[model samples]
Target: MRDNYREELDDIRGCLVDMANSVGSQLSKATTALLDADVTLADLVIAADDQLDATRESIEQRCFTLLARQAPVATELRTVITAMRIASDFERMGDLAEHVAKVARMRFPDSAVPQEVRPVFLEAGHVAESLVTKAGTVIAKQDVEAALELEEDDDAMDRLHRQLFREVLSEDWPHGVETAIDITLLGRYYERFADHAVSVARRVVYLVTGEHRINAAG
Candidate 1:
């Protein structure tokens, strides 16, 4: 019986890792399209999001099966609940990637962001990607410390988001109102992605330590 429970836990972890990889690839491709103005890559990001949706459903179904069949307790129950929570976060991340791809497709010949702001976008994307990847590691390794560190990494994305808005809204910036809106929206997408990643990390910390971390209340 113990061995059977262990097997189920392993299955849950495997499914989660697969889901994380799918969402991470979506984020990476979306970032590439935004940075290079690659319409093809944007299209690919849009198409790939469907796979993540399917993966989420598959994981959710497996979790439900385990709950019904095994009747998990304590840590096992927590693991299954965490799996569900993380899957939802990954799905939301995929949606945010699609939003970015939409912005890329919106401006065909020109990129949504100005050349000057490209670096900021790239940095935010990197931070957001790092957050997701790190959350995956925490899940696999059950590393509470690494999960805690995600909050600090999220700060960089927040700073860059603010910097992007400040520059776009500056009177001297020359791209006009339309350009400002695009960049503002793009920055927001990246920021929100990072925010969701942080949310996942907090759940990981809770699962490991059994104490909820401090975060903004809904």
Candidate 2:
């Protein structure tokens, strides 16, 4: 019975890793849809978010079941609880990516991003993708070093976000009101997506070492 319970815990962990991977893939496609203004692809991304929702729900159910049945202690308790928290973050990440796809779909034929700032958003997308993938690996291995490094990776996204503000706020900006709103919203979605991934990594660090590291920004 004890051996079976341990296997169940491992299965729950596996589910969380798969959830992270799915969110990362969705983010990649969502960014492509945003940059190219592909409404069809955007629509696909938006609709598929339900998959993430289901994954999170399944994870939560398993976690609660463990808490009720096994009464997991110490690291085992942390494992169940942190899986729930990380799964929530994973679900929110999906929602952020969906927000980006919605903006791309709303603009339809016209690209949501103007040509001048196209490179900035493209870079944002790249960084967001990299952060989530790295976050997943940290969870899989519970590597405190890798988990700590996510903050630095997130810094690159922050720099790009501020760069976006400079572009939009400039007096000579040509995109005007509607494009400005799109760009602002798009930038936020990317930034928040990365933030959620960072949160997940922090939780993983806490689960492994029992110390929740403070974020420099916080």
Per-candidate TM equals 0.95, 0.97
Worst 10 residues of 1 by lDDT: 209-218
Clashing residue pairs in candidate 1 are none
Q: After best superposition, candidate 1 residue 27: deviation in angstroms?
A: 1.3
Best by TM-score: 2
Model 2 root mean square deviation, Cα atoms: 1.2
State the lDDT of candidate 1 residue by residue for 1-218, as single tens digits: 87987887788787777777777788888888988889999999999889888888988998898889889898889989888889998999999999999899889768888888888888888888888888888878888888888888888888898899888878789999999888888887888888878888788788888888737311
Alpha carbon lDDT of each predicted model: 0.84, 0.89
Model 2 alpha-carbon miss at residue 60, Å:
0.5
Q: What tens-digit string does per-residue lDDT give for candidate 2 at 106-126?
A: 888999899989999989988
